[model samples]
Target: MPLHKVIYLSNNAKLYLWKITEDFDALFNQIRLKDSSLARLQTMKSENHKKGFLAVRMLLQHNDYNDFDLYYDAFGKPHIKPQGCSIKDVEISISHSNDFSAIVISEQKVGLDVEQIKEKALKIASRFMDVSHLENLSKEEQIKKATVVWGIKESIFKIKNEKGISFPNHIFEDDFNFEDKKATATLKFNNKEEKFKIQFDSEEDYIFVCAFESIKN
Candidate 1:
């Protein structure tokens, strides 16, 4: 389908979401990929994976940017450098799950992650989050909360984009109600402590997260 949604996190940041309802031919024909991107697409083993990849590029085109304007760094963090010399200082992050793909572009550093709510998140909750926060909730609620916490850490890690950052040990989510739909977290790594302001919401059965560096930093 067309761009599923767009959200403004701040005056300088905007998020776009795409729901994959089309097959590979439909997406592949809509955009032109630079050689590298085309090569990467051909290597994807899953039909869903290839479709998600194309959906991201389709979202880029919706914003008046195209595949040629995007690139990645050594750490595999996606970056945007729009064609021509008119644009600069644009930061981009991309993520996709089973049926949705999302990207966030900002003048400030940002990170994004979208994961479908599933029991697996709860099963591995102790491996990456503070499980005590999951108390006092039904099994269903526990899964939803666990998914948010996982997205919280993943989003923060994307912002840092540094190696050796462990979710359970280095990233901590402050106590907050899942109903709040927003939260704050601290990333303690490299002898420094960094904070993030996070906003999250549900789309269909998936949870999408956006994390920004705390202005107080």
Candidate 2:
């Protein structure tokens, strides 16, 4: 399976998804990794996690970039070296959960998250979201909606990539209709408030969310 799916988050941003159907060795053999990537891969305790890491590299290569071109900052945020004399530095965000790994590359700052839909996200809904939003949905809908909210907050946090941002305390998602397949959130921290635009979709029981910092914020 080359790519599970691709979404154009915007004119300048494209999101890539890889379903981890291949085993670790199958994925590992298809891509090249720098020494640091290899070291980081070795430190992962879970095979699924290792595969996720490898799959991210695969996606990078798919875009003509390799592991050598990727690096991380002190906050563990992933970055891509500006190639040539491009005016805007290319931005990237990576996330994986269970069986899928995802990456989004953009000229604009972007954040991405892929989540496996399960009972756990719903069970902890109260800890991070306004549970009242779940009141009218069926049990199944509740689970999916809760997962989306969590993903929204996660993606926004990735975009901000700063310290002391609390999901429950700082990130707030406005009420949105499921039919809309879109949402907006507000981040209020450090006495500063910012807004973000979010888009999400479900694929094969997994939810993928993308966050872009609002230009006005």
Candidate 3:
């Protein structure tokens, strides 16, 4: 198991990235899975998704947890049951892109998304992002920026995990320069609004974005 990188986002939040170098059997043999998780893994249509799923369990194990401590809700959001002796609650988000799988664990409300850089993201930018933000930049820069913006929207959605949150209509990302590597977004849904603090960075050919609900909310 090659643990690619570990990022400490804040005092209570940390992110882990795993480069999927093991074969399916290798990964499968290493982690313990619950019955429901085993059934769910069997339904995954692609080996990449299975590898990503198993790799996430590897990450959980690295953090002293296993599949038994994890669960999902009706919305398909992942959660962790803290050890009985521990005082802090745990929040987690998971994402995978190509040969990489990543997870973010936090004591605060958090969301995370990782995306591979692709021209398609630029082509569909108008559907989910403010196109003007990509203006005056080179084509490659536009793709990177557009992908980051998409990731920003996804991260915010994961944090809120509420119904009727459309990426284009409900999530609004503030203007940001690519060099900053971080930004903020507002999720306006239902009849109220909340703000999120966002941080993003690139690794290899992928963009990783993490969101934390603003304390001011």
Candidate 4:
């Protein structure tokens, strides 16, 4: 029960994070998986992935939902099915990093991503983000900021779940100070534009970001 942390973003949305401190068998014994999920788990090549997958189910159980309520779309996005006719649809987004797995649920469409902070993100920041944003920052700060930007793009991509969306060309994040911990971004794709509200934070050595579509007036 390494439920690391929980963030209540809004009345209708929240984020759940699990720190992977349990072994595979311990996690697997605590939750039941569907045939498809079991098959998928068996196919995973790494033990860490299996543990991450199981940890997600444990989170679902913590939230009172189970594997039976979850499904995936053609684009491979994960979702949850309302249990009854009176129940409202719940939007879900899942992400996993080195030692953490997270899920965000909301009445509105949402996207989430968790990534381990690393120098690689800084080295490749220019390809997907504005390099100017990294100037005037220490090397460590640069890595943190770049990782956040990358997470921002990835979260937006999860929300859209569309094809032909390039991180640099299609997604644009507004400039903000590192202290903000939140920002806005736009996705211009398929001849249309949409806006997103982003929230991010650093936990241990990883960064987790959540995105929600901006409400239109």
Candidate 5:
């Protein structure tokens, strides 16, 4: 079957989700070879990375499959040019797991991440959460709370283009019912605060959360 596509447009940003259907062998053949070293391991990780790259190319509307060049920043984020040209002032991030790959494109610096919620959520809560957040929730409420918290933190980290921001300390989300389809998050940075609305969509077994800065004049 052909892959599925999801597009989200808001705040001058475009978010695309591509659902993969090709087998690993067929997908691997689509990858371009840079050198003899490219012919190595056909492992699952390598296959997924190829699919993720292809998905981004499709989103960018590349006509020829091999007619693009990808560059990376010091942090290893992918940047694209049509064969050999470059587009300026555009930022993008790509993420995938299991069956889907997602990409976010924006005119401003943006951060995007998608995570599958798991039972291990509770175990990792303390590492990302701040005291006030812990005090506000009971043991049973922690998992869902942690997922939203982590998403917000990840989005901010992507925006800031750095890591190690303590959630509930550097950021905070107003009280929200996780069962709701959407929620808003407020982030505090350097004594200034910005607000964003987070929307959720469930695809198969994973939840996708997207947060972007509001378009302001």
Candidate 6:
């Protein structure tokens, strides 16, 4: 319904996930219509657009039902500004699947992604799975292992604000026991090494996994 989960990674970095169950028409009415035709075309994409608009309403605390003036950068990232809010240096990422739309906000540049793990071809895992890492797991453990690895790579891409990074090569996972419900990923980017902690939880029939950059000294 509201603030399903709040993850605090550091003093300045955190994430907020909200579950939307409101009617699409009410959600659409909350968005301000722009004169530009392109803006109108964008809104027609799906009901998710309306949900995203409503989800953001809680963030700005606006009640007039006016659409907040928001835009994305050349790289397709959402940007927001509050009239009287003093907090700057905040970054956010929004994702929606099924009946849930999540918004992750942080003071540092951050990326957040949630995937519903599905059955896929095993060969696809080779693209992202490290040879050494795969050798250690048996046939059944491979799927869960690969899913966690893929999530780590995706989160890193969001953190780096770029794509085209090889999963298994650029991102590697250390010895982890998924049975413990927590794992860690070691990633190399820009010639620097960073570590990300991955946490997995079961929501209904879905496995929700998230990765966040560890606080640096």
For 122-172, candidate 4 gives per-residue lDDT tens digits of 999989999998889999999999999999999999999898999999999
Superposed on all Cα atoms, model 3 deviates from the true structure by an RMSD in Å of: 1.0
Global lDDT for candidate 6? 0.60
RMSD of each: 1.3, 1.2, 1.0, 1.0, 4.5, 4.2
Q: Candidate 5, residues 1-217: lDDT per residue as tens digits? A: 2436555656666667767787755555655544422433334366667666555555455323232344566876665553335445666666776577777766665666777776466687766665355466666566666666677677766666545456657766766666775667777777677877666666666666667675566
lDDT of all predictions:
0.92, 0.92, 0.93, 0.93, 0.62, 0.60
lDDT string, candidate 2, 1-217, tens digits: 7988888878999999999899999999999888988998999999989999999999998988899999999999999987767667899999999889999999988889899899998899999999999998998999999999999999999999888999999999998776687999999999999999999988899999999998962
Against the correct fold, how does model 4 do in TM-score? 0.97
Better of 1 and 5 by lDDT: 1
**Which is the better candidate, 2 or 3, if ranked by TM-score?**
3
Q: Give lDDT tens digits, candidate 3, residues 46-138.
A: 999999999999999998999999999999999998977987899999999878899999999899999999999999999998899998999
Clashes of 2: 0
Evaluate model 1: give its lDDT: 0.92
Per-residue lDDT value at 128 in model 6: 73
Superposed model 5: Cα runs more than 4 Å off: 31-69, 80-88, 130-145, 189-192
The TM-score of predicted model 1 comes to 0.96
Q: Which ten residues in a row have the lowest lDDT in candidate 3?
A: 156-165
Clashing pairs in 5: none
For model 3 the TM-score comes to: 0.97
